[model samples]
Target: MATRFSSFVRCILYIYSFSTFLCLHAHEARETTESYHLHHTHTVQVSSLIPSSTCTASTKGPKREASLTVIHKYGPCFQSNKDQLLVLNHTELLLQDQSRVNSIHSMFSNNSDGNKLRESQATTISAKSGLPIGDGNYVVTVSLGTPKTNQTLAFDTGSDLTWAQCKPCAGQCYKQVDPIFDPSKSTSYTNISCPTPLCTQLTSTTGSPRQCSNSKCVYRVDYGDGSFTTGYFSKERLTIISDAVDNFIFGCGQDNEGLFNGIAGLLGLGRGQVSLVKQTAQKYSQFFSYCLPSTTSSTGYLTLGKDSEISSSLKFTPMLTLSQRQSFYGLNLTGISVGGQRLSIPTSVFSTAGTIIDSGTVITRLPPTAYNALRTTFRQMMRNYPMISSSDPLFDTCYDLSKSQSVSIPNISFFFGGGVSLDLNKVGILYVLGQTEACLAFAGNTDPRNITIFGNEQQKGLEVVYDVVGERIGFRPGGCS
Candidate 1:
């Protein structure tokens, strides 16, 4: 009787243990399945031209995968000339991929967790277009000489400085844009004196600064867009709104017609002695803003001052300084997410600390894998919208003009230094449109030139503040408009 009782008790204990083991296994399986579903939803299949390494999890700059061949067919100043000449020369440059520049993973994992705002009397400005012209930030009209010369010309930030195609040019010169800077004749034009602060930092991708023994101030600048501007950095009257500030100038290259206009020069923005922002910030508090209008609008505003309209929700983030040779702000990335789903991209994408917060571009470009992952989620969210197609070269995706669907996409956010987060509407984060059926255009194609790019379209309705003195920036969703 005793043996039978002991055996019965053992059997009961064994059954209880088995039941608990099964429950534990079932719970683990459910957790894993949920995780897999979340990851797969955000993965996109991108063109294989871009490398997989570009999407790694480091804060390094992006790598250029291929060369871009841009043949300028028409520009506003020279479109009527009908010249097929390659005015803007395209070169292969190493650019920082935007994806790798900001990592979402690190943003959440790091210490201090980016929650504090630096105590400073912060100023704000609207972002502007750095191309075509100043976008109204610093409108500098150039001529052969001082006010007496009156050879009025336009100023462009896309170009490095203000310069005309010079006479007896030493390099390639296209015939369509004809007005050239005459170094020999402009009486007011004198060589930027050597040993001056500007001369030490003068440089470009071409070679060392030409000895300024003559009257022409000379320097060189390589652009993020693969265009190189060679010119002199000199003192000129720069009109920033109402103030006539003496600023360093860029006398651009004759070959620049490949990418530049017949305009007298470029407006420097690099950290060198001749940069427009560098020179002007000395007196104006180093605060500026550009209000880029919607793609449908024809005009915008570029204001310089402490703009107080920046969202109170904004947190100032740290800025990473790149090599002196390069321009544009750089930042470290942690990772990115859609809805709440995290992506499983490689860590190489954000390894280099070389991403730019540029206002000139129209869309955000990323590594093949990273771009695919985000794009996949974006397409899914936008799938319900009606499709429309147009011949407009500017349109990237097709959408139905009449189909009005309430936007239901989630807000996309970016995590950067100082615990700052930048959020945007779901549709605003993508470069897709549903204008028509069967006609799909990828407006912002990921090029080999830049691994990642954050363009103007993503900046719509956002207030971007540049506090140069503070070495920090604050971005607010929606515009100062």
Candidate 2:
């Protein structure tokens, strides 16, 4: 009798434990489904990309992939008649970068300043076009809405929120190639409520509070270039390659102002949820790669999902922590080598705090200490060449290229942390200003507050892979064109 009672009790306990375990499992799954269903989504965990959790298992038939043919900013899309025009273009672009740096300063600034601002003062905050100041060299045409409203947008790895001009503007809107996206015309459009986690993610920026208008989440973005876009946060089906992704959250900007003159919107490839990469993570496993053609006449492409080909070819280094300004990808740049001679600079000068790889900025900017070391070493190597003084702050290291003799630019290499080094030739290190002139594609960032940007110049013809799961970025030499 005693043995039977004990066995009965054990069985009951086992059953109870199993019931609780099932309940917990169901609850967790429900939460995940709810979060994903909302479409105003969260960032993808690298762990989630594993084979078991990938979209392949559940997706029937062949997997659908989207590709965008990227055009160069200065290429045929924005053709110029004069070489001087290209020179002036870089000057203006650099000024835009300065403004972008200021915006970063504001983003990482003491929240106490933001906290101190009266509720009214913090309200305002957020534009781009034909390879404009806020844009990168590559551009893509993105289609959003049910009937597939196509808009040409600049691709930016530094920007977070993906926004576009929408119809029924209360204040201001830009002149885009296509008419504004009418959310009402789309069957899949829906406004996000303030109570949802998506709203919290959108408003998490300092001083960018949660503002609900007519029971919808309203967002205002202030970009690095002082461009501002204010609109409602909503979800809609974004069509690409005849395939559509439903419930993609984006900004419906009614008042978007700034350098965005001819384009429709921005395709934010930043490391944030509001970006295109993150939005498509569940379907694509948050893996995306791009190859930028060296020149404007060539074509490059952006691919979604894992690429076994690119991965095998890349050599990678761990990405630094999100110490500040979460959008930028921080990496430890230990030192630089000019003509095979490493610059004797302190490691602290390459602190991960103020270093990033940006897709938009054309020229690289390093801390004054690091820049001077690189410049001094480079100039020493090129003592034979005639130096051309420049009054423009943008082109500091100009050289007279009018001479028939080509400057034998020594091989320059950048050393980053974790045994990773990037070797750049003259083409990658210098931006030729017409046939008569050329300049070192680097700037002295005297302001300690600003971070060093690994700009497009350094990234030319390299297949840079952002491996979020591994927390590393890989680079490989390739003919992108």
Candidate 3:
């Protein structure tokens, strides 16, 4: 099965006896919510997604762009029919909050420590429980383990770390990704001592249990949706299709549910603390690119060898490089237009200098102002159609289901760096109710699921290329190979 990178948002509705109720089109606040799982089918192929090329060096300049190339790298998903990778179904991560300091202290304090000291420390831990928002520091990913024979796994650019399930897990495990991390066999596997920086920070809010120090390098991670994954850490063998003799730092996860129990581990694409990309690039060259399809993104190319595919016209947007954090790619968005009509929104969406271009996130979320601009423009263009009263539950732009072709919304386009524009068509009409042509707006929200997601729906029919070497992204109008 494909890694379940996308997460599901549950829905709850409130019904009243009245035939027409004053409907409140409840919308979930848009934020960079974490993912639940990674889904990949065994049939996914890299060649189908990327253009093949021989590795070539770029012309060195003050700032030279690398040649874009896709190398031939294959893994189990390519050869087998069974789902071989375990993935986390959903992740619940929050910026550490000072209020959680007490909790952190209790979680980190050794019970063997004096009770009075532990209580005092608990107060301190709670105060520093959550990390500051947008800081992009102090994050973690707990994987299940490694490939027994040989397995190829996808590395996610939007993730924080890459790890797999380890053997000898205390709880449940998945069948895919051979040979779980048997902590007993791995000589390098060692628990994070309670006083160590990693252990102190990671388990501070949860209160470090004495059991963790007993010699196992085990860890636990909880997500926002209530699912959790636990496993041990170890120095395992990592093989890159590009090269085999060398190895990189990887993890072995275990005892995870949803999607977390299947695959060897994750390939974190997020910027920070020596990710898989960084580690791998160090061995070869600091260069890689991803060509994501405009259609269903069942496949894409991750190039580490060369940059031969570099388009001369590729727009280079200025990036705000964050220190001590995973540096992310940003866009200098100029404006968004619908059917050639420009909206009156600020360029801050593009100019904020930190608009994270993360694939890990399913939605292409814009700031409040950016969102309003798009909504207003869409509503204006859609004025020709009769507006439905908020009382209707079927659609925010409700029309009698009997009415044929009553609503028409134009295709919206987002123009970004380097003359690149991502144009989304009726797909932006993006959501419909259960096969019927009803707007998604009418979907009542009781539990605030992810409503503002600029899901794959927005990305359909647009070719996107993430150039890691150039530190920029490129786009082409048509579904160019």
Candidate 4:
């Protein structure tokens, strides 16, 4: 019942956000918004919003680009028969503003003691919230606890902490299709203490330390979409295929709530102390990559480490190294082009904050300046077609495809640092409405973070690699088979 209610509430919120726009388009079609949700099934990833001085030689992986000689691959996580329509949201926009506000408040609020770092005493618990955006999260298979209990989970690059539901749950556990993870049955499970450094790192706000529940370290996380996961910290062995990440720390969520329906929980890949990437940095070389399957029916893969020499043929884009906001993977984008001509938007518009390549977001999002420039150019090229107007922010360029025999969409490109140019697939540029209409697959972000995202839509059929250690991302076309 909780799960059903959570899903229902999400759609209501999405409609509310674009209620005016949706009402305007009410006459044209009933599935305009539903159709948009059909193609994209990804979610928003957030790194730890809390600041912690946990990095040391033992914690931070070597600053060298790791070799991808032996690939560890997993398929997309959200593979299921269930319907995936949800309120499409992102970064902060997808979830609650209160969480972001609380994060900011923590940053400026005085710290209670002298032990914590920065905010002098002002400490913002790094925000890591996954708002239910759509049905598409890149699902991966992993096992936790001893004698290994396998779990199907979502892999999020934008998140840093990994967690799962565990038992001794009694009344606290949400009903799931699979058996609840019984920690007592596992030989590897160990409780985390409240006074430990890791517990202190899990503070809810700026100065407040993580609390102790039943003498064990307790952690609480709330998302922007009014969902949260709460549990005690535990240490256990995590198995990805055959590799065993021992002493792995993850939350044993008891009071967990939100958009997650089929999966057990999440696999955090954010750039933070608790992220799986940092935990496996020593063995995996602090880098990993994934190729999302072009369509929902096919299988996609997530690979840890670098690709072989054949990957040298891929185009390269230099990553913007952000020291303060280390949780995000920032890319230096110049501008975009349509019909082989670059848009007139200035590069400064893209530089509003930091552009990160995210697999969680289904459609690509640009700042208003960058988006307006590309929209204008595309409109110019698409003047022959009839325009459809909507208040829904995601649908900017809609066309009456019913009147046209076939649409010869022009080439679209994303310009980035290191002279890298990404040519997008035609199908990825336009989303189809129920039967007669089609809309652009991109959106304009008005976020203060103004973070431009090259979402999964623009990344279809491509083998994209994130070389975090070297500060760059590599892209090669046509691999999502």
Candidate 5:
């Protein structure tokens, strides 16, 4: 009887153990399925992907001291004669963008030898401008010279020297919508003399040693596409809207040629001492914010000073200072998430090459490791949609959603340092080629070590704030209405 009781107890214990094991396994399976669903699934309607035909005005934040309207060069909002518009196709625009990127990479490569020049300390001032020019760039208009000749100039954060084509055209000048700025006519125009501290500063700013032209400091800037601008380094009165700064250093190009799209010249917003950001650091406190419109047809604004109201909404990440490339803004990108699921990309993949945020680059370039994981996951999530072939090598994942009124897409978000996650707007996700065709806006770099670029396309509808004094970059969504 005791043996029978012992056998029965043993059987009962065995049954309970087996039952518990099955339960635990079932719970784990359920948890695994839930985790997969959470990460791999995001469904956005197709109609939300299309951009509006009319211009969407950007919403104003707190009252900024100085603000300028930002316009797309090819958009209808930019008022210029037909001759002034140098419209480029998508392919041409991408090519120009690649050229800009190549120039940046080359600059870094050339300067990596640790023999980089140091920027000189000099008294600086502030200025502003307006207007839109170029195929993929945004432009602003600013008044230059004593009498306040209003000139439309393209503003570029990648470049450091504010330049405009001057009257002489000693080498040659390209056609511009505004009259060629005649420096001789302005009372405030003064050529920077060679051997001056400001002249020496040009070596660090332009990456080329300063040249003397009749005792005046001469500057030459060469773009990657063989476009060159050479002329006198001078100072003049620069007015952005109502704010005016005297003795504002700028380039008076006697010889200029490039695909400038009939704009007067460029406004340098780089971090260098000669850049507008550094020069105006006192007044603006080294603070600036800009919103790139979703479509070229839309209008956006660039504010020089901080907008106190929008401060709380912004997500900030530390701004890194690369010794080799001080002019460009650097940031650490940790990971990417698709459909709310963080990709399986290793953090080392992004850390190896480093990354920079650029205003002039049209398309964002990602490292191959990150790009492949993103593409694969994105394709799996979008398997329901029909795939289309693209002739452009830059964009491979194209989709044909012409027939579907409401297709689904995965949402993408970028994770940066400081635990900041930026969710891109619908406009930032895909490049719409036509009614039927759209392609992923991101591309993989040819070389993994090539620096990753966060281009302006992904910045659409976001208030990108650069606080140089604080050493942080901030992003606030829904900046554009």
Candidate 6:
């Protein structure tokens, strides 16, 4: 009887130990997960969704800096003929965005050794013109040439060559608010000759073979959306807010066609040898920062030089430069937190395909695994709100809040390498289609191997600093203010 009692006591002890283990596991989970409250986000009003007539004040920065006002191409602040602006629906916008993404992927997949340089040859000036501008691009005004003619151009971090439609459009030129640049009028304009080192760089810059048009180096850039620009590779003076950069290599397109939306041309802020950033490296030290306004009606600032006060408030992360793609700026996205809870996504999921921060892409793209976790968690937290259907295939998670006077959203943050945690602004979390058709601003890539993109939508209201010399990218909150 004593032996039987001892066995029974051993069985009771085993059950007690198992129960204790279960309780500890549950407690640990609870500790790791955090809850969110509505007070963490700003209340978004439906009336504010409409674009305001007057432009909001530009983000204040240091005086004497090479700062340019950034205006959304579709916003009211962009003064242009109403007919020039094409009203693209959400579906059309996503289509154009996908086109740009596809082009980037193609560029990465088709990486190859550039063409060999040819023998030295003279340059012949030719009259040519081309179209410019992309959907959802931002425009900035700058002076060009000896007389310094004001020209509004779209700024792109994804492109390398800076080009504008030059005068004497013997071939084809699209309509633009500013008169096409006349090289004859500017004494400073000079065509780049063939076989020159600067001209050979176009092979890598445009991803096209070097061509000489009547002894002049010819450049042809084909965008993903079927937009093409072919023009003489030339040099001219580029002025940005009183800072004049002489001998700036740019494209004087003679043949161009695209939906430029009345913009003169493109300003390449990419990380290539021929990009504006590299051309002005001596003056700016390869340092530049831009703040995208939260709303279309608001104004933002793009500064070329670093500001001491702004630099102090920034949180930095290591910038990655992949061998296959050198012009694009890369970043390591470690994890994401929705409603204050960090999703249980593996680091390998993000590291496999890699990530890039693009000023052109509108919506952020995530790996399927990471996106699924984020979407599921976001849906659970937003369960109280009514779910709505969206016609746009890109946006799947949408909520209807027409009845509510104010929106109380859960806080979302992104954790990057080097312990950098960035809390997104309220505008970044939800993309308001209307009062009733609000949706999460993120989307999932079809394949996990596809590279992730951190789009400009999430970058609104924050100052994004690209320090090429330091090899780091920094983010500061409330930069648009």
What CA root-mean-square deviation does each model show from the true structure?
14.1, 22.9, 19.5, 19.2, 6.5, 8.4
Predicted candidate 2 versus true structure: per-residue lDDT over 1-481, tens digit per residue:
9999999999999999999999999999999766543432212222221112111111111132676666565555433212323323656766776676555545544533221111111111111111123544567777888778887777887776677888887779876556788888988898889767767667664125557877788887666666777888889888767658888878888888887766677877766656776667777766666666555455566666674555465777777544334555677778888776788988777663347777777778888888898888878766766788864567778776565343466567888767988775334676665555667788877665456778777776666777654567777766362
Deviation of model 6 at 271, angstroms: 0.9
* Model 3 quality (TM-score): 0.54
Regions more than 4 Å wrong, model 2? 1-64, 78-88, 105-137, 194-201, 205-207, 309-311, 479-481
How many clashing pairs does model 2 include? 7
Which numbered prediction scores highest in TM-score against the true structure? 6
Estimate the TM-score of every prediction: 0.56, 0.75, 0.54, 0.71, 0.84, 0.85
Model 3 error, position 65 (Å): 20
The residue pairs that clash in candidate 5, if any, are 129-141, 129-142, 130-140, 130-141, 130-142, 131-139, 131-140, 131-141, 132-139
Model 3: lDDT equals: 0.39
lDDT of 2: 0.65
Say which prediction, candidate 4 or candidate 5, comes out ahead on TM-score: 5
What is each predicted model's overall lDDT from 0 to 1? 0.43, 0.65, 0.39, 0.60, 0.77, 0.77
Task: Judge candidate 3 at residue 305 and give its lDDT.
Answer: 45
Candidate 6 all-Cα RMSD: 8.4
If the candidates were sorted by their lDDT against the true structure, best first, what order would they fall in? 6, 5, 2, 4, 1, 3
TM-score for predicted model 2 compared with the true structure: 0.75
When 3 and 5 are scored with TM-score, the better candidate is 5
- Report the error of model 3 at residue 451, Å: 16
Model 5 gets an lDDT of: 0.77
Q: If ranked by TM-score, best first, what sequence of candidates would result?
A: 6, 5, 2, 4, 1, 3
